[model samples]
Structures are given as structure tokens and as C-alpha cells.
Target: MAATGQVFLLLGSNLGDRGQVLTSAREAIAEQAGSIGNQSAIYETEPWGITDQPVFLNQVLEITTSLLPEDLLRIILNIEHDLGRVRYERWGARVIDIDILYFGQTIMDSARLTLPHPRIQDRRFVLAPLTEIAPDFIHPLLQKTSSKLLQECPDTSAVSKIP
Candidate 1:
């Protein structure tokens, strides 16, 4: 049997029914990626990078999976594609966006993916939800807990939990 590794995924949506899209993403992840162990409350956050787009609904999920990092990336890419994602612009509005935040303690920088997400400490949107569910989950390379990262995050963009 393959070893199951703990993974964190960040989900965001700014197009179509954002809440529904997030719900569908969770369903797809559970079916195609792994069993979800924990989930943060949904948050409505100001757009990052390209700020002209609509605000996004974001959340973080902790899951257990046996697939390796590359394979996991492939699965999530397919999940996004299946849910109507287009790559016309970077940080542009989308029906759904899923990002791999961490895969156990694995760290890698490659053309395809980066473990512990290179920008976790810089984005309040990512940190808010992540801190909610795994406040103490340490960034493999940063050597800081999620809560600490959230406190130190420099992105001034607003991030608020959805009621």
C-alpha cells in the first residue's frame, strides 16, 4: 500500500456562483484527489495581483492522499479544467482556482510546481483560511507556523470570513 501524505490545498473562485463553485471543487477534490480531513470557513477576499477583477471566495482544505506531488498537481489541474477554468490571463477572474499549498513536508521548485507555495507568506487571502484550519502547520521551508505567517503577511488586501 502506498503511504498517505497530508496535503493542504487552497481554493478560490471569482466567477459564476462562487460558493457553488467552491462546493463543487470540494466534491471533486474528495472524489479525485484525496479524503479531506479539515476545511476552513469560507472567506471573501479582495483580489490580489491584478486588482481590477472581482473579489474572490477562498478556503483551505487539509487532505490525506497517496499520490506523489506531480500526480497530485495533475489531478487538481484536471479538476480546475473540468470546472471551467481558462488561462487567458494570470490572476484573472476564473470560475474556480485551486492551488497546492503543501504536500506533507516535501519541498521542490520546478517548472511544473512549487511545494509550500512560494507565496504563502505574502498573501493574506491564502494565509487567512490556512491559519484558520491549520494555525500551527509549519511551512516546510519557511520554518514558520501558519499563524505566524498570517501575522507577518505583508499583503494589505482585505480578507474576511464569510457569514
Candidate 2:
């Protein structure tokens, strides 16, 4: 039997009722993916990659599942589509954005999905929430804990924890 692995996912929304959008996405995830684990509090963060978009409310979730990386990506894309996500531009304003951060320390680079998320080290928005929930979880590539990475992260983008 294939052992289930703990996966980390990041969710963000900057369009419509951001809070509700995130909540609904989380609900969908719980229903489709395995049980949700430790979750970070939402953080309102300035847009990255593209600066002109609305600030995003971001959170990180820890989940345990047996799905392969590619299968997980398909499920995520379906959920995004179901929630009205439109790919207008890279890093553009979005109704909801779901990213696979880590899948059981699996490191992979493919045309469709990238594990340990390629830009994680450079994004404070990602680091802040990840650190909140899994501060000691080491990066598979950089081998540094999330809190340490957050401390050394150079991205000056504002990331404030929500109430």
C-alpha cells in the first residue's frame, strides 16, 4: 500500500469576498483531498510578480493525502475553475489561487507542476503563513526551515497577519 504523505498547500484570493472565497476553497479541499491539518491564519499581502493587482489574502494548509503530484494538480485546477478563476495574466488579480507547496519532501520540476514551489524562497507572502504553521519544516531544496527562510527572505513585500 502506498503511504499517504503530508502535503502543504497555499491558497490566496484577491477578488470578490476574499475571505469567503478562501473559506469555500478550503471546504472544497477538505471534501476532495485528505483531511486538512494545521492551517495558518490569513495574511493580507501585497501582490508579487505583478504589482498593480489587488492585495491578496493568503493562507497555508497542511494536508495528508495519497494522491500523486500530477493528480493533485488536476484537482487543484478543477477547483480553481469551479471557483471562477480565469487566467488573464501571470500574477494577475485572481478569485482564488491554489498552489502545491510541498508533497512529502518531493522535489520535482515539470512543465505543469513544480514541487517545493520554485518561488517560495523569494516570496514573503508564502513564507509568512508557511512559517506560522510549519516553522520547522525544512525546505527540500534549500534545506532551511520556513521561519529561517522568512527571516532571511529579501522580498520586501508587506505581509500582515489578519485577525
Candidate 3:
């Protein structure tokens, strides 16, 4: 195999055994891609966007993979579907939610996908754990570090670290 691609992903679950769903999603990512690298502590966070749902358990992980962005995305979607994630609403509570936060330093945007996920900088669920692994990781679009983005984010939703 070639050198694994460096990728960051945010995983969350707010329905049906949230913790177990997250762990299973992690396992699926590792199995379907290549290997799991470092993972951040899980977080219990208040729901954003759509509010009439359960609180979410979220975390970020650094994974090394040979899969391209699109292929990796498909794999994540498969995991979500397999784990019973319903595709009903935007920012709705889900059984498993997996988002590609960054693919190395690549910046891409298309009708179906966007690199450096558009909302990462605004969400504590994404940044809190990212800062743990790569506090200085630069946002390709904003040209700011993860720590800096976290500080600047206007989102005041509570996020608690969990093992």
C-alpha cells in the first residue's frame, strides 16, 4: 500500500445507543478505509441547527487511508446507513453521523461535496476534538488554526469531554 492519506472526520450520534453507534462507526471507518490513527475524547454537546432533538455525543478522529475523498465519503455514508441513520432532515438527530472534516490539506468544493467541511470552524463538536489532535491545523479557507477558530466561533453551546 502507498502512504496512507491523512484525514480528519467528525462522528456523532444522538439516537439509539449513541456511544455504541459512535464506536461502531469508528470501527467501520477503519475497516472500510485503511487504519484508525489518533482519536479524540468523545463529547456530549447540545444540539445545533435543528433543536428539537436529543443531545449529541460527538468526537473527532485522525485516520490514515488510501481512499480518495469521494470514495471515503461513500464509505462513510454506507456506515451511516448500515447503522440506521435516517436521511430525513438537515442537521437532524441521527443514529450515526459521520462527516469528513478534512482530507489532508486539500481544499475542494463541488455540488456533492466540499472539502474542509464548511461548518467545521463553527461547531465545537468538530473543533474541540480537532484542537486536541491538531490545534495548529490550518483551515484552508479561513487560514486560521483550529485553536484560533475555536476561540472565534460564536457558538456557545456546551460541550463536555468524555472518555
Candidate 4:
């Protein structure tokens, strides 16, 4: 039997009610897949990539599920759509953004997905909350824990813990 896996997902919003968007996304994930192990406190930060857009609120979640990586990706996309996300440009402002940061220890490089997210190490928004939940979780590619990666990530973007 295929073993269920622990997956880490990153959620962010720069438009609408950011807090509600994050909550809704979390709930949506649960509805689609199952329970999330833990959800880190929300954090507000300046937008990356496209600096011209509004700042974003970000959070990371750890979920354990039986869904395969590709299926999980589709589910995440559906949740984003349900939450009013419209993808018109890269790094654009969004109502809700959901990204699969990691799926267990799987490292995949395909046309659709890449495990241990290629840019995760460079994004403070992703690393901060991730470290909060799984400090010792190792990056399959970098071979470093989330806490270590957070320490080394050059991104100094301001972030705060929210209830």
C-alpha cells in the first residue's frame, strides 16, 4: 500500500481580506484532502518578485494526506480559484495564493511540479512559517532543515505573527 505523506503548503494573499482568504484556503485544503497537522500564525510581508504590487499576508501549513503530488496540486489550484485568485501575471497581487512547498521527502522535477520548491530557500515568507511548524524538516534538494534554511535565506522581508 502507498503510504500517506506529510505535505507542507504555503498560502499568501495581497488582495481582499487577506486574513479571511488565508482561513478559507486552509479550510478548503482540509475539505479537499484532509486535516492539516498545524497552521502557523499568519504573517504580513511585502510582496516579492513584483514589488510594484501590494504587500501580502502569508502562512504555512503542514498537512498529512494520501493524495498524490499531482492530485494535490490540482486541489490547491481549485482552492485558489474558489477563493477569487486570478492568474494574469507572474508574481501578481492575488486574493489567495497556494503553493505546495514540499511533499514528504519526494524530490521531483517535471513539467508540472518540483519538490522542495526551487525558490523556497530564498523566500522569507515561506521559510518563516515553515520553520515554525517543522523546524527540523529537511529540504530534499538543499539537504538542510527548514530552520537552517530560514537562517541562511537572504530575504529580510518584514513579517509578523498574527492570531
Candidate 5:
């Protein structure tokens, strides 16, 4: 049997019925990726890199998966495509965006993916929901808990919990 790994995934949607899109993405993830072990409350956050887009509804999910990191990335990309994501520009608005935040302490940087997501500490939108669910989960490289990272995060763009 394949070994199951714990993974943190960030789901965001800024276009086309954002809440419904996130709900659909979560359902798709649970069906195709792994069982979701935990999830943070949805948050409304200002656009990070490119501020011109619509605000995003974001949440973090803790998942248990048997797929390897690369395979998981492939699955996530497919999920996004299925949900109407179109790659127009970096940090562009999308119908749904699912990002792999952490994959069981595994760290690798290739053309396709990065573990502990390179900008986790630099984006409040990512950190807010992450801190909600995994406050004590330490970054393998930064050696800080999610809460600590959020405390020190400089993104300051505004992240608020939503109903």
C-alpha cells in the first residue's frame, strides 16, 4: 500500500461565484486528491501581487493523500482547469485556484512546484487561513510555526474571516 502524506492546500477564488467555486473545488479535491482532515474558515482577502483584481475568498485545507507531490500538483492543476481557471498573468484572477502549501515536510524546487510554498511567509492572505488551521505547524525551512510566521508577515493587505 502507498504511504499517505499530510498536505496543506490553499484554495482561492476571485471570479464567477467565488464561494460556490471554492465549494466545488473542495468537493473535487476530496474526491480526486485525498480526504480533507481539517479546514479553516473562508476569508475575504484583498488581492496580493496584482491589486487590480477582485477580492478573493480563501481557505486552507489539511488533506491526507497517498499521491506523491508531483502527482498531487498534477491533480490540483487539473482541478483548477476543470473549475474554469485560465492562465492569463501571474497572480491573475481566476474562477478557482488551488495551491499546494505544504506536503509532509518534503522540500523540492523545480519548474513546476515548491514545498512549504515559497511565499507563505510573505502573503497575509495565505498566512491568515493557514494560521487558523495549522498555527503550530512549523515551516521546515523557516523553523517557525504558522502563527509566528503570520505575526511577522509583512503583507498587511487585509485578511478577514467571513461567514
Candidate 6:
């Protein structure tokens, strides 16, 4: 497969059975999004955006898919809904939060989606795991590698890998 269709995704859950939630989400993703390639070790992270919520178990994944970026977004939203994700507030605790971190080399800036996720440069929770699998992957917009982004990240929230 060409590199253009390769995509990176982040999954976070702070509600119930986080590990199981992630596992099932991965299964649904393979069915709707594409094949799951490299996946990072799950990380336990403090809340971001809204710090008054439960801490999250986060995981990052690399996928090779035929679905267009928007289509993939639709599928992820569906998965989140199926997993009982409720967006009562921004960055609030969720059953499952699936974010499209990167979509190959595509740089999109639309109302619905944005490629090379705008906040990745500062989120250690996202960068930590992403660097595990795609350390050298470049941010299409920032022109920086994942490792560099993680090193330079300013978000000080605690992050630790889980077995």
C-alpha cells in the first residue's frame, strides 16, 4: 500500500472497562475504517481540556485504509456512539474518544476535520504513544517529527505506559 492511505488515530476512555473498550473499538475500526497496523502501548493520562474529569486510558494506532478521511471520521464517530460516548462537554470524560491524529500526507482544514491534528504538537498523551510506533513520522503542517513533537510538547500532564 502507498503511504498516502496510512492514518494515525488516538483512542481514549475514562469511563468503564477502558482496556476492553479499546479492544472492541479496534475491532469495529477494522470493520469500518481499515486494517490496524502498529498500535502503541496503552497509556494512563490525566485529563486535558477539562481537568475536572476522570483520567483517561489512551492508545494510538496506525492504520492502512481505503476509506476517505471524512468517511473514516464518520466511522469513528459511529464507533464512539456505539461505545456510548456522550459529548456533554468539550474534553469531558467519555466512554470512548477516537481522534484522527494524522491522515498520511493530506493537509485538510475544514469544519468537520483537520489533518495532522492541530493540538498534537502539545499533547504528550497523544505524542507519547504515537512516538512509540511512528517516531519519525512528520507532521504535515508543523514539519516536525513525532519524536521531536513529543520532546518539545508543553503539556505536562502525567503519562505512563500500561502493560
Say which candidate scores most in lDDT. Answer: 1
For model 2, the stretches where C-alpha displacement exceeds 4 angstroms are 1-3
Model 4, 45-100: lDDT tens per residue?
A: 88898899888999988888888888889888888888888999999989999899
Flag regions of model 4 displaced more than 4 Å: 1-3
Candidate 3 least-lDDT 10 residues: 1-10
For 14-123, candidate 3 gives per-residue lDDT tens digits of 99999899989988888887688888999999999998899999998899988888888888988899999889999997898889999988889988789989998788
lDDT tens readout by residue for model 1, 5-53:
5699999999999999999999999999899999999999999989999
Write candidate 2's Cα lDDT for 74-154 as tens digits: 999999999999999999999999999998889998999888799899999999999998999999999999999999999
Q: Estimate TM-scores for all models.
A: 0.97, 0.97, 0.95, 0.95, 0.97, 0.96
lDDT per residue for candidate 5 within 129-160, as digits (tens), equals 98888899999999999999999998889899
Clashing pairs in 1: none
Query: What lDDT would each prediction earn against the true structure?
Result: 0.93, 0.92, 0.88, 0.88, 0.92, 0.91
Model 1 / residue 137 / CA error / Å: 0.9
Worst 10 residues of 4 by lDDT: 1-10
Scored against the true structure, residue 151 in model 5 reaches a CA lDDT of 95
Clashes of 5: 0
Off by over 4 Å in 6: 1-4
